[model samples]
Target: MSAPPAPLSELPLASRQDGSHPRPQLIRSTWADLDGTWSFRHDDADTGLAAGWCAGLPAAQEIIVPFPPESVASGIAEPGFHRVVWYARTVSADDVATAGRSEHAPVVLLHFGAVDYRARVWIDGRFVGEHEGGHTPFTFDVTALVADGADHVLVVRAEDDPHDLTQPRGKQDWHEDAHAIWYRRTTGIWQTVWLEAVPATSIAHLRWLPAGPAAVDLSVRLRGRPAAGARLRVALRFDERDEDLGTIDVDVPATATSVDVTVPIARQRNGQAEDELTWSPERPRLVDATVSLLDADGGVTDAVSSYLGVRTVGVARGAFLLNGRPYDVRSVLNQGFWPDSHLAAPSRGALRREVELIKDLGFTACRIHQKIEDPRFLYWSDRLGLLLWGETPGAYEFSATAVQRLTREWMDAVDRDASHPSLVTWVPFNESWGIQHVADDPAQQAYSRALTDLTRALDPTRPVVSNDGWEQQNSDIITVHDYEGDGAVLARTYADEAARDRLLSGMGPAGRRILVDGAEDRGQPVMLTEFGGIAFQPGTRRADGWGYTAATDAEDWIARITALYDAVRASTFLAGSCYTQLTDTMQETNGLLTAGREPKAPIEQIRKAVRGRP
Candidate 1:
């Protein structure tokens, strides 16, 4: 056919780069996105390493960067599995225009948003570094090699075993065909790859936590060698109403790489204004801040821009609390897949619109099912005001290798996303998919609990769900999954105190124990985390699609969904409820919207159902 349409990554800018800062958590002015056309090939035989293809790939076709070769958007939608792949691209002078080349030994980092499985990289044919884990980002400092001031070619080789059951491949069917809950695979480089130049000394990572009613705490980590008499300055503002909520300056110790400081904000005189200063789905007030690293002479050496929302999350009196208020949570299970892009988003605007669409449908939170989302999505969630339940993709098999892979990757995901104010909960496991025997297996139960405790150690600010839906080894929130189609049956099952007590004790929903650790009630909040999968597509059947339950017509679909919401709301037991899903995937058609994100019913009806209102 004719030439395919230009990919989004290659298109020129008007409202470009998805309309948000790349790497929103920490942003410096000196950076550029390496997200365009690239030379590509599938090394199915795995001869690239021995053949020395890392130095260069002589014969390769063109494909779009950031879009996996499995996707149509990549211009190389190969259906068959390829265990190995290689990509090559030249770094243009324009790409490095902002990376100040004059500084003596300035640090320049090549940041990969994400690469599936394991990725090995080379700069100008010289080996640089490699990173494992498919979801979280990794950066390599190429300053030493690229400092020669010449052309540089980035060649990447990625290895992913389609048959590896122990790998944390979430919802990716190993077989050639997509079936059941599993969808397509994203083999390599499914996110943006870019570069940033920073001063020798800089701020590496940090997080802002709501310390109390009137203060927020900061844990800042510095990179490189600390200078004597050096200092760090931070300034905070809200809505630009106050230029400086607090201006903090602390002297940096010569040997210290990290520092913690508490910034106290002036309490608002008006109660409503004070509430507005806090972040929520209704009123998303963001606190903007600037971080500056000063040299011994007090001259700014490295400066970056960042922001956070002031909020706290907890479980108290058997209810989920946000900002100390018993806020009811309405969540949707988001697979974050696209017809054109699979696991990767179609565009940056799509990421923003995804958040707006969830809000439009009246969801307070989104359980990002089985995948670590792009940081751009988290940035929009923080900006547009939506809560998130961060969940990791599970491995199908239980083994030491599986546990080790899932645990390390999950922790890295937690560390990358813990700074986002919108992330309210950490779900390390789901449905006990990896540790399937956790309910009766002592070893599995201990591993699950240990993982939960480890997540807490990483970020104590958010609640940890040891294993969601069923067979939970440890959890701060008791969640259960039930797909009972009838609203009347669903209501009666969770009608009164006795039914609630029964569920907390031994009886389970979906025929799986809610708590498998054999412990008494810890007085945790109970939620209908998964329910109501009413599948209804308006047109003819395609792709042999199906759902947990099917609806007849649009009106019937809306009514059935509404009745379930009403039942959940009427129950005296549940603090919150999450529906089965937001959009229909390949073979699973039980979605309020289609895979392309088109609403099956009217937006108003869906929003009303989600809100539990007429």
Candidate 2:
């Protein structure tokens, strides 16, 4: 809004895009995005015990919000920023007050879109809360600690060891191991930073499930007691002028832990039942719903708004399907890395630009391979209409114990992002990273199957890729990757007998495959999910082993991808195909966009090869 608040590299670590012809804003709902100047400093240690931790810690260095400390977007691209760092900023107490207040609201929330690994926040030198996961968003209420209207200081201490023994660090290499795949790390606050004012009895999280036709079941959990004899009523509104769907009384006892409130979906103006709006590549429709918490006497207690779409995704007929239709997903493998910002997105505009570029290139979906994308990306996909296949970051080791914890964290990620309409599939393990004794290891295969089953249990609306290019397991869509084979070898290898076994057994790395002829159908189709990474040389000189080059220049790259896409399309046995990438990420120059999001390969070449050429 306000001139995008200078470049993230020039400001502090606080901070927090483009295509689709006339695409809608990707966010499910709009809110103030906090990405401007904030006070920042490097923490001296992990204890957060530095003197003058409150009342602002010295200089007013303007740190960019949302870009992570180590990123160029943070205005401080100092290496090893992930080792340990401290940040401090200040917000007003008046900021938390409502237009009309009794002067007694107990808590104020300081929200961080995401903080890598671990974080401890102090308000006025009083510890408020600590968070462990780095890739997911978290919030803390600092009301009790800060003095009202006294200009309180907020201190944040964050630590991220990319090579840590326990945490999950996807594709992040601390050192300069910028070869194939691995990229750099993003530490500290890398997402939105803001504060929300809520009543002491306000609602916390919402869980709304759309069950049956044109109806959604609802449950709201709140903090503090409801006003005496007050009854909570929930309403669903679809439009500004539409009549609110009649509110339903929420039954909650004083001792109750949660309130059960069911609000009916709205009916159309023409008297027909409101049709369920589901989101998919072909037709993306989102329904906006606002939930208002009412007191027993019909007084409005608090209201928080959110949006949802009624879509079903699953693996069927050997391929991922949406809304019961056979959806052939043409995807680009997205690494979620940036040259300036590293793992964190440089800016919201940058995220939108990347998604728009992917769609413009005729790709219908993206494999958010390994790293979990920022919520804003999912927000855009849900709003702007892009399909997403999400995967867990590969860990360094695996076992029954390790896999169990990994499974839980993976499920947590799914729950965190369950409401977005763009997410179509969940991938647990990729290329056997961290997997030990996978081949011929029944235990490993079983571990994979268990995780897949776990995903189904968590959210059955989407399909599960139990293992992608790892030893076979019970999965919905059968997926594989290919890179080692040349043009002729790749073309013929799919039909090879040995290759068929490998495909069936879900074995083989790039360039080689073994297909199975008689494997029982899991009701899912087959896909060469990762292939066609034909690296043609860019015109500029690239360091040896730094870029992809099956031949040279954009033309060669286009030819190879075109051939691969044609072969895949011609094969009736293939369900879909995803190119190696959407953009050239970091050292992997095979992407359509150079690392800087500049210099795209010839669009005509991609259209000729990928779009209707076959």
Candidate 3:
């Protein structure tokens, strides 16, 4: 079936229109990215030439607004220049004009959907703001730096040295070479760039939290002078029903970061009064919240609205649980890679299609494997009611500085995506990657523990997998990746077969026992985390292009993967399982769909195999 065209706002800013498709609701509304041609430079200039970088900039390159430079969709396939690049664009207050607005709006904001590594933004050639971390969005109020209603020149400098540094580069490598598991380095203006007009003395941002049982804790921060009697009024709403939960008032001082307020269930209504709306794959409920800053006189100054779903996810007694119930995570390991778009998908519809495909196959959840997914993907998962296990990208080595940087990236990623109901798990490190000398590495263990603690502290609603596939260092879930693909062995251990068989036939172990003696454990709740990588080549295709495997046809791919699935179904102990991947990547042919977004095996075969039915 042909895919539906993506929504306008989800497209590159250049393609979005004022009145095109049906207006999609934007949770955290920000007006940015509607402007003139952006200037591009593949390399950064020295301080001597930095001043003239935006002035007399190069001609229009016709690159798409939001796609990354390395992506084919971005119209720039310069893979060689992946480390340092600069982008400059200009926007006027009129560029972001509202329906009925006067010329008095004070602060004009500049926003970046995301930028890799470190980035410094300059407005009208004056330094405005700098941000670290690439995966999460950041914004700067550049109003005072530019003229009131005139065109403002914006310049951005982004530098990414992936593998060589302590920064959280994920699967990105400094070398221009793409090797096993690592793809091309995507650098510079990967996400969207936009602008917004707001009052100079307004609410900067809101940090909304779900504090259990119809209670939401909000911390609102305002720009300009907070010490001079600035305050904020917060309100919660159930979007599906359009019902308001009243509002709360809080005072803020100038030197303070943000003002806090608690919205209670007794006084306010959150979505449907279904007794604490806990979200799950079967029942996903999201609470719409609007936060507004009011002047001391109680007049609205600035407002921003977002959504949050109340749910509790954790690992208890060797099984993953949701809302205090044992919930087996039947999932697929999603790589989030496309043949054409590399890290980013061609369109939001493409992302939605992936989620739909998973749902059609009768799986309840998915483990978004390594790389962080685009926000729209999570949005669909929440709306379509699919559980998600979010994980930090695995790296080759783990250093103290690297762990610190990873922690920051993790915090930003989870913070930005915490509102989505689909997400239920946060995995800090993946199977021995970046981990060396696990036996005596106190620092490594401590770092892993710290990240787990930090993640819990940030959003205590979800479970945290401290280390997936390795040492059982106090992780919430004892996750094990068994690639053996033997049904009898799994069933025996999982079914509590016998001690003799567990030692002799290599079977029969049960209930959270660690078998560190083997290469990887095969026990209760045994998840086939990295199995069924049977590659099948579609005729005339270059199966050798990608390196994971090279089986020569659809029949072979189905045969091997189906056999593995059959074995897994026979195991009584296996509570959950995840196929190696959902789709084929650049060099990984084990995907159900080819890197070109073509289905390799028959759809019927995939549906039956994944659902564990004949």
Candidate 4:
């Protein structure tokens, strides 16, 4: 295996040996981070299982948990493709017990932030669980095998096939060398790992649906069957204040695993009418919540802390509405990659920095292209008040396996992120990647429609776009991508009623029709989802880097960018626009910022051009 290259820059957050807690929602004080170093081995011949490596690997190299072997942060730094990889770590019984696990809370859950493609986990030589998705969190209960005052070996085996189009690889490069837009591949665990101790009958998942400014429907899914007379107690409070807004208790049936509780915000409190607070880009308000499962004796069996924002998103009259008002979405396409970390952020601070940078650049929204971003980033987006278009990574080929993988992973992504108020829309496919023949193929069209319908069924509060960009199937928004550099040409192309009618009625740019046959415009909101891939290399362009349009100098870059913005802003029919990218990636130098996150153009100029304000 080739050694991994040295990282160009190391963020301070990367120095922490124990990775931070991965889950921000439903947080518990009783948990231990299982990050640091672990025993590692490469299974080239896939003989690890036969060799009984899960029991204990002999003479194995040490690797940093959560960091993939392909990353420099991983001590092994093995860049070559290893079809099978084995990792082993030992956790002390004291550490597990310290998490407040007892006869009442006897369950010890092992959580993996994410493992690439396929993962099989073993606790003390017994197979506990297996997960197939690469981008969502999974957990296994190991209380039955683990004993107090003893150490237990935890082993994991991960397998990833880059060339397998059946798997959703996202932007991870398939070939040996990074080419075009695809970059380095992530093989093993690339996120945080931790152990959480909880009561056997604890809350497993939380879903908060804010129906109105003063109403929210909260659903709690329990880990175990409810006992007789058991009830879920919920209390709501403002994060900034100590006063409790309200409290409610819902009786959970013994046969039910989940129960919904309706919470209505009080209009008056403390002898005063409560101020109407809604979450928006300018002012974000989050309501802190304390959820507890109380036994018949009024004893708390389990408890967790969570938060939610009161907001609503909808589409009406060809415009996106936020809190019942037409909101203009000025966005930039963000791939959410780091120079050192491929998919994982260097640290929590790095994720915060990315959100701050986007807000400072005057963009209200970020279209996270081709990847389900880390939950921490979504947390930051919710806290920092930035709109997000949650997008799924593209699958290149079409097949039954492709449909299964994309549908399964995409649904998981949506379910995982459905609670965040920052997420405004769900995009299942981009530019007809896996469903390329949707314009002609009935099966493909039906598949696209199925995904759209499924997304809506899962999250009806948010809009669903079956396929973003050209040749739209049934979608809530009519979006297109055009990189016409000349301002006059762009202005003329999407000019007035006649021009729009001609373009929408017939062929669009590059002789591609905007709407597929049998699909009529349903007066859905229109937005240019992609445009202005202006590459502005400070000095000379690198031989490997390329963009749709190149600028000779800073002055030329500013003029071209301003012209494109002018055209987008002048179009009365369009509701929003998203620039090609936020930062440059490997071989794609069309970002306003470099790959290292340094600004390539003047911030003020770019902001004015994008937001049409100084």
TM-score of each: 0.95, 0.84, 0.82, 0.93
lDDT of 4 by residue, 1-614 (tens): 11111111211111111224477667766678888889999898999899898787778999887778877777776667787998999988876876546666678888888899799999878889899988888988888878565899989999988788778877888886778778788887988888877776788999888767677889888898978988889887774655578888888889889988888887532224333457888886777777878777666777777778888899998889898788999999998877667777767788888998999889999999888888888888888889999998877889999999989999888878888888899999888889888888989989989999999998889888878887777899888888888989998877766776777778767556788857887778888899999877888756556788888777788788889988988887788889988998877888999988887877887787777788
Candidates, ranked, TM-score:
1, 4, 2, 3
Candidate 1 contains a number of clashing pairs equal to 0
Instruction: Give per-residue CA lDDT, model 1, range 296-356, as digits (tens).
Output: 7766776666788888899988899998899899999999999899998999899999999
State the lDDT of candidate 2 residue by residue for 1-614, as single tens digits.
11111121232110012221111211111122345666677654543364655435665456787677667778876656346777776555554442122333345666676787788887777777888776766777666665355666777777776656446677877564554677767777877776654566766665555453455656566767766655665554434244455556665677665776545554532234343345566556666554545555555556555556666666654556666567788888888888888777776677777877777778888899888787778767766678888898766766554565466568768867766778878898887666655555666666766777888887766777767764546667777777743656666657444555556654466432222223354545777888865554466545543433455656666767767776766665677777777666666667776777654566666766777652
RMSD of 3: 6.9
C-alpha RMSD values across all candidates:
5.8, 6.9, 6.9, 6.8
Model 2 regions lying over 4 Å from their true place: 1-35, 38-62, 94-106, 208-213, 217-219, 225-234, 237-249, 259-276, 399-408, 440-447, 484-488, 495-502, 510-523, 541-549
lDDT, each prediction: 0.83, 0.63, 0.62, 0.81
| Stretches of model 4 off by over 4 angstroms after superposition | 1-20, 241-243, 268-275, 541-543
Q: Write the candidate numbers in order of decreasing lDDT.
A: 1, 4, 2, 3
Report the candidate with higher TM-score, 3 versus 4: 4
Candidate 3 lDDT tens digits, 1-614: 11112221232221122211111123223354442246666763444244466442465355565566777777776677456677777665566553112243455666666787778777767788788877777877665766466777777778777655566666676567777766777676665566656555555655555566557666565566643565666555555556665666677666766677776745324445544455677876666655555555655555555556666665554456676578767788787876556677676577778888887766788888767777777777776679888888655667867776778888888876775668877887776556554435677666766787898898876767666654545555555655544445444443433531253233212222232322233232334445555656578566475533455667766666666777666654455677777777666666777776566766788777776673
Highest-scoring model, lDDT: 1
Worst 10 residues of 1 by lDDT: 1-10
Evaluate model 2: give its TM-score.
Answer: 0.84
- lDDT of residue 314 for candidate 2: 62
